[model samples]
Target: MSTASDYLSRLISFDSVSRNSNEPVSDCVAAWLQELNFEVERTTYVDPRGVRKCNLLARRDPIAAQEQTLASGTGGLAYFCHTDTVTADRWTGPGGNPFHAVFENGRIYGRGACDMKGSLAAMLDAAQSISLADQMRPLWIVCTADEEVGFEGAQYLVDHSAAFRDLASLDPVSIIGEPTRLSVIHAHKGIVGMRIRSQGKAAHSSTDMGINANVAMVPMLQTLLEIDEQCRTDETLRNDAFDPPTLTWNFGVSDEMKTVNIVPDHCTAWASMRTMPGVDGREIVERVRRRAEELGLSFDLYSGGDPMHTDRDAPFVKELCELAEPYIGANEPHAVCYATDGCVLGELNRRIVCGPGGIAQAHTSDEFIEIEQLENGVRFYQDAIRHWCC
Candidate 1:
């Protein structure tokens, strides 16, 4: 197999930030996979901001290995990854370059190196290592866009990509390479978002003509605070398996009119909350909606898909634990505090989150993946491919 670091360097060079179109990165990956005899399909969607995003679904089948492959391969293995990273606006990598990949002190430094591009490199290299003729089942790879902003690309793929639906019919064992430091992740939290806004007439400071939209936002903000407190106090929503053990809230606010001389004609407040597995995220959504209706403020609510969870004792989970733990010196699968494409691709019921690098380095100004993790991730994926596909 080609070295993962080499592949990573090339991938890191493509600045596929979530806010920008991922065409360059997506096109590159699609071409690379196609060159390796994988049948690749490209799908696209327009983001809410009107940016054109892409998703690549690539597959390899050994017609000579099994008659099932000649027809519809009902069981195989699938690897999931995203092509986008958070903004590189705060990039502080070597020489103030985020797209220029660098190897320093036993780590690879670049934007998306740890967050996900490194994982993508490993997956491709591992898949390349296995010969098509030696594999009895199909191998599928899914690369989606906009994972950092939201799972918008994944959601679009799930809904529109016929190739994605075709692969899903195979009941493939799923692996989400989301920087778990190679420790198998059995579950993680889900995200919920709400946006509230008010509009009023703008005017001069001395004028009574101004309707003062800020006045309406006050009641909505207060209600959100009360709900946040409610979530913090709700023991039923707690999950001790995860750190912090409860749902957490993040609030963002802005007003159109910046000067104090005039009443703000437009005010917007948005909130993000993470929902634990087995917790009802809709409860919060419902409460926020009722408050908006009461206050007559326009509001929007979106669930970023359900929390992902696979039974700890499931056969696939056990096999993954046995295969991946020694490299990390860990014994069992664990839970994380973040969501992945698994939340959106739930139809592939057998899923695990395991990959190189730690989540702590993800999306940071100075992002990097330990060399050890990157190399081991390559071996882990190779082992998994041989065991599950070959």
Candidate 2:
């Protein structure tokens, strides 16, 4: 079997930036899996704007396209990992070109090296080694696209004809291979994208006849801060596994009035809220809207994902933790503040997040994955597949 570290080096060299199409990387992975005797099914996805992307679903033998058989008593398993990475910005030092693979100081440096191409490579290489082995439940590996955008790739695959109605393991135990530093992730926060518009009367600043939209933003920001604080102190809602257990609100993009002399008629701000499980994101949004209406400021709060979690003591969770102890050392499973493809995949299966690399290294310059982490990841996944599938 090819070592995951060597496979990762090649994945780092592919340059599958989120802005750039992932067809090349997807094609490369499809070719490798097929060579290992996997039957590949490619799903073509078109964005609302007509942009097309690809999702590859590869499976092993003794299963037909219309087969619905799953290993009885012990179900099937799905391995998911995204091939796309965020655009590498111009940075000084080793990150000048994130596409160029660099292996030094016991780490691998590249654009998608840690944010997840490394995990993808490790999963792919490991899957290839065991694709055709006789097993109880079939193994399914999904290679998705547009994860950097909105998880379009994974979402499409789950709802696609092949995943829901046709595949053998209809509701497999889904594992998202993100950079979790080899931690077993049973729960994480969910995101809600929102936009609020503050309205005002337009007039010359000198005339003092205009309602300043900029002035209106102050109270909105304050209210958001208050909400954030509430999220921090709410005891019943907090999960100690997470450092802070509550909804986190952060500003996104905003549209402001330009000239200081003119009081603009509209001031728009985009914000997002990441909520913990059991928090009613939609209700919070309605409350924000009510507050805006009471203040007489035109505002809109659109609700997003409330947050999702899996019982830490679930059988699958227990089995996975047991499988990883030998490979990853005393495993400490926990929840995180970030979101992953697990949110969407949860709809189809019992899902968990586990992989190599620290979350701190993701989305940063000089992003990398430790060589030891990759090796451990390889072993953990191998064991999981054997324990569950074989």
| Cα lDDT, model 1, residue 47 | 87
The TM-scores, one per candidate, come to 0.96, 0.85
Off by more than 4 A, model 1:
69-73
lDDT of 2 by residue, 173-286 (tens): 878889887778988887877677777889987897888765676677777777667666766546556656666667643446566788777777666777777764566677
Cα lDDT tens digits, model 1, 323-387, are 88669665798898899988788888888899899999998999999989998999999989988
Runs in model 2 lying further than 4 Å from the true structure? 48-50, 62-74, 92-95, 166-169, 199-219, 256-265, 292-306
Report lDDT per candidate: 0.87, 0.74
- Whose lDDT is greatest here? 1
TM-score for candidate 2, residues paired by index: 0.85
Name the lDDT of candidate 1.
0.87
